[model samples]
Target: MEHRVSLITVGARDVETLAAFYEALGWTRVDSPDGVIAFDLLGQSLGIYPLAALADEIGVPESDLGHGAMALSHNVREKADVAPLLDRAQAAGGRLLKPAQDVFWGGHHGYFADPEGHIWEVAWNPFSALGPRGEFQWNGVG
Candidate 1:
């Protein structure tokens, strides 16, 4: 019951394709044990596994592996990076969900969906401070 997440695994319709997409974004991936692909993030690991495999491991039918209303995000160091990040996502076979724009909170952000329809928000929040390696911290500022 620690307040830390060790890993996050998503059901990818095509693990190979998803892995390729991430590699295209310059992410280095480590081969997974079976039916999965793993990428080491800052403080966690992102795992991509086949939907059917994940469902079977959970004793659920593949049909139950449905998409949910949520977004995974990556915060950037500068506002200028938002657009290029979105563009990179698109080039990597992702779809642009929202064009980069200035936000009321004084940030720049955009949204994109991976080939499996998992939404990701790329943002540059001026008020919040990121760690040395681009880890986000809620600065409690406007």
Candidate 2:
């Protein structure tokens, strides 16, 4: 089996709605077939699909979608960029969870929830440098 992830599918209650939120964040969504939308990231793709359809395809109930236990993160290039990113998220229908602040690890971070309650963390870690394509080579979120 491969050791890296090539895609990430987010089960959204409303596929189009959630997709728009990401689009508002300046993410260019790639064309996908019916019932799914995709956004190409630095080294992977972010796919958005209807929650019910995804659950049915997996042969599980919608409750199987892990809620609070997991979070998606986007690491920025500069510490000053954190607040604006969080603001952009909030302006795009995401609920502000934790306002951007200095973390104990000397980094700055914030949290927000999409319209469907999917948690996303926006952080700036000086320790983990982002390449030109926004790829983070670090092992941890910090």
Candidate 3:
């Protein structure tokens, strides 16, 4: 199996709200009427679909799901950008899980949960290298 993730579809209670949140983050929604909205993220795609409908389409019972204890992270260019990015997340109806602060590993980071309880981390590491898409490449420095 390949070790690459090409798509990530998040089940949202309200597709419009979820779409709006991401749109506010500068993601443009591709036009689709299949009840699934997609956003292009660099080379990958992030999709939002209605929860129950998505489960039905996948042939899974919605009640059989477990808690979504996973988190998606976004890395920024500088440590000073952490707090402001976090503010944007909060302003977009996400709840603050952790205020931006220094981590034990010598980086600044924080967490926030989207309206649907999907956790997202915003972090800044001085020793990390970032690609043009703003993703971080950990070089084992800080």
Candidate 4:
């Protein structure tokens, strides 16, 4: 399998609400077929779908799908940009889970949870500066 991810889908209890939350975050929606709301990121697309439908398709109960154990990260180009972006998230209906602070790994970061409770980490990693188009690499862009 390729090492890159092409898409990330979130099963939401209310698709419209979750979609709106993302849209409020200044993400423009990409044209997708019915039942899925999609936003095209730098290298991948994020899709939001109905949680119950997702569970049914996977042949599992909705309760079996967990929401809190993982986090999606958004990396910034500078340390100073972290807190403001986190503030923007809060203004857009997301709950601030952690105020921005310097981490032991030498990064400045914070966390926020979307309306559906999906955790997101906003960070500025000096070791992994983003590309010109904002694509992220583990050890800085070549």
Candidate 5:
């Protein structure tokens, strides 16, 4: 397998509502099949699907499909862009989990929870400068 993610799918209680929340965040939807909503990113796509259906497909009970201990991160090119994006997420019906501030690692960052309760980190890492098209690498864009 290659070291790349083709898609990141999140199960939402209400797929349409969750999809709209992403749309509110300035993500335009691509043409996808009926059961899913997808937004294409630089090299991958974010997918939203029905929570119950996802649980069934995974052979798990819906109750066991709660939010996991993981977060999705969005890296920005400028530290100044951190707070505003958090605010934007809040205004779009998400919850602000943390206010942007200087990190011990010499970066600025914050967190927010989308409508489906998926946590997301918005960070600007000076050590990992993004590529020309906003692709992220752990130690700066090669």
Candidate 6:
């Protein structure tokens, strides 16, 4: 088993709606016909599949699995962008969990939960480096 995650597939109750939500956040679907929509996140892939179908494909029962204990994070270049992105998330059917604020770690960040209860953190760290794709390069600072 490799100690790396190549993909993160989210089981969405409404695939098309969820896809549109992420697309509004600047993610493009990778061309595919299986109805599995995907977005390239840095060098990794984030996929969205129908909930029941995903459970069937994985041979798992569709129950309250509590797999959303973790959150996905998006880091930005300027601290000023955090509030606007949080607002966008809210406008796209996501629930705001936290308002953008300065963290004890010295960064500005906030949280939102998608329609399917997937938590996401949008942050802006002054000491971090951003790639062309808006992905972060850790700067080893608090």
> Which candidate number maximizes TM-score?
5
Q: Could you give candidate 4's per-residue lDDT for residues 72-121 as a string of tens digits?
A: 99999999999999999999889999999999999999999999999999
What's the CA error at residue 142 for candidate 5, in Å? 4.1
Candidate 2 Cα misplacement greater than 4 A, ranges: 66-68, 139-142
**lDDT string, candidate 6, 1-142, tens digits:** 9655789999988888888899887778785788789998777899998898888887878775446579999887889999999999999889999999999988999999988889999998877868777656778332
- Ranking the candidates on lDDT from highest down gives 5, 4, 1, 2, 6, 3
Clashes of each: 0, 0, 0, 0, 0, 0
- In the range 1-142, model 1's lDDT, one tens digit per residue, is 9766689899988889999998988899899668678989988989999998899999999998898888998999889999999999999999999999999978999999999999999999888868887667778332
Per-prediction TM-score to the true structure, in the order listed: 0.94, 0.92, 0.90, 0.95, 0.96, 0.86
Off by over 4 Å in 1: 140-142
What overall lDDT, based on C-alpha atoms, would model 2 receive against the true structure?
0.89
State candidate 6's TM-score. 0.86
lDDT of 6: 0.86
RMSD, candidate 6, Å: 2.5
Question: What is the Cα-based lDDT of residue 13 in candidate 5?
Answer: 91
Clashes of 1: 0
Q: Write the per-residue lDDT of candidate 2 for residues 60-138, one digit (tens) a residue.
A: 9998865657889999999999999999999999999999999999899999998889899999998888876788868
**Residue-wise C-alpha lDDT for candidate 3, range 53-101, written one tens digit per residue:** 9889889898655447789888888889999988998998889999999
Q: Give candidate 4 misplaced runs (Cα > 4 Å).
A: none
| Top candidate when judged by lDDT against the true structure | 5
- lDDT comparison, 1 vs 5, better candidate: 5
lDDT over C-alpha atoms for residue 49 of model 3: 89
Q: What is the lDDT of residue 129 in candidate 2?
A: 84
**Model 4 C-alpha RMSD to native:** 1.2
